[model samples]
Target: MTAVTTDPRTGMTILDEDTCWSLLSSARLARVAIAIAGDIEVFPVNIVVDDRTVVFRTGEGTKLAAAVIAPRVAVEADGADPATGRAWSVVVKGRAERLDRFADIYRAEDLTLPDWTGHPKQWFVRVYGDQIAGRSFETAPT
Candidate 1:
């Protein structure tokens, strides 16, 4: 078992820099939501997190088409703390872009995802977060 320490400054349950890095490294799946034509669209995606960048695969139809044109999007992930009856969540707000050859090579070293379903027309999309915010809540002990 591993223990996580909380920061004092933000009662919001601080995830230390190292802990944040570890969580980002270990989490494989995340929900990505984007505002499309005044509607919210969300999809469960297998993701590869590289520092502040998130990458995932999508087919050519809807998700990809939206990403190609969308100006902003949000990505989120979270975990629960049983002892404290609390949970923590993190959100990233940023722009979406199709990786170019240079970025593909740079990100390739850390690329990790479950084996892709056989989909030939699929493409990879990366979201580079410009802003990040996190929060946590805990119930008073009984």
Candidate 2:
């Protein structure tokens, strides 16, 4: 396991870009937060990451409806290392758009959504991250 050494000037633990991308790619699930009817709703989704976009399947419910009209959304994923007392988290702010039939063809080759018990409409949402930020936590030498 690699350790995080803090920068003396900024006092923030530095995580390399590759390390951050690795963490993002390794995450299988993410929490997608959307605004609906003046209420903030968060849904746990099984997502597949494609470069800077996140794709997932959902039913024609609140999440789907919101994404169609309001594509602006937030998605987050994180993990922590208990032994090292270190943790990392990344948040993606992006817009969600419904996938068209043409785009579906490409996604089919690269991603698959397992069948589950739910409304089987199989709505697909693609989130394009406009801004991505991440942070790593480390305990100062005591």
Candidate 3:
């Protein structure tokens, strides 16, 4: 539980930083959106939460290239609780950097994450969210 903001019209709850980070810590799948070559591209990534940062593994491709270029990116995750008719979404906007430091790389190695692609992912990228926010709302009745 975080900021209990209820919209006067919609009853939407605005989540605070701590609640946002809590949701991120429990979620493993997120979409990373990056702007590259004058276009916006989104990538579905398997991520691990390192405190307030999001970390994922990638190969030398657009995802890696965009991170190296130092562009502001967005990582978003959402969840729905049907029984409670509640749906929530959290977004993290920040810069993505490649984990090149020895300590960072070593620590990342210990973070066991499943690779659905089963490809050789040798690079670790961390997204530092400059702004983080979330909202919770009641789903429309069927």
Candidate 4:
């Protein structure tokens, strides 16, 4: 059975770890946030959950460059059931490592992450989720 938590302050609900993982797996797109030169930036990318880790692909660009400098990153993915007015959001904090080894790259290829752009995305970034949290809320009726 899935557990649900209710907040006393606003009646919002908190999701358990199991529920969070389920939502993460169902999400196809997420925002990868990283700090670059002391400034924070968020980039939207297609992602997949693998072994409890969030994986995505990017090419030689600001996103890759920043991840190289700052290994730690935070990722956020969210979804809502419009009919029910129930929404859930998940956030993961972890270390971002670039996979360069042939074996690692080969394994990542199996993920089959899609790139919306036609450009080739060779660089892969795997975020080892160290801490994860999620929450859900039922909006007031319209």
Candidate 3 vs candidate 4: which has greater TM-score?
3
TM-score of each: 0.72, 0.75, 0.92, 0.91
State which candidate, 1 or 2, has the greater lDDT. 2
In model 3, which range of ten residues has the least summed lDDT?
Answer: 111-120
Please estimate how well model 1 matches the true structure, expressed as its whole-model Cα lDDT: 0.69
- Candidate 3: residue 25 lDDT (0-100): 81
The alpha-carbon lDDT assigned to residue 58 of candidate 4 equals 92
Give me the overall lDDT of model 3: 0.87
The C-alpha RMSD in Å for every predicted model, in order, reads 4.6, 4.1, 1.5, 1.7
Cα error, residue 139 of model 4, in Å, equals 3.2
lDDT winner between 2 and 3, please give it: 3
lDDT of 2 by residue, 58-131 (tens): 87588898888778898888887777767777778889988878767466446755424454546778898887
How much does candidate 2 score in TM-score?
Answer: 0.75
lDDT of 2: 0.74
Reference-based lDDT, residue 10, model 3: 89
lDDT agreement with native, every candidate:
0.69, 0.74, 0.87, 0.87
Give the lDDT of residue 103 in candidate 4. Answer: 94
Please provide, for model 1 over 1-142, each residue's C-alpha lDDT reduced to its tens digit, 9 standing for 90 to 100.
Answer: 1225445664456554455545655667778898888898887777788756888877657788788778588888776668768766677789988765876856643576662455543467888888766656574575
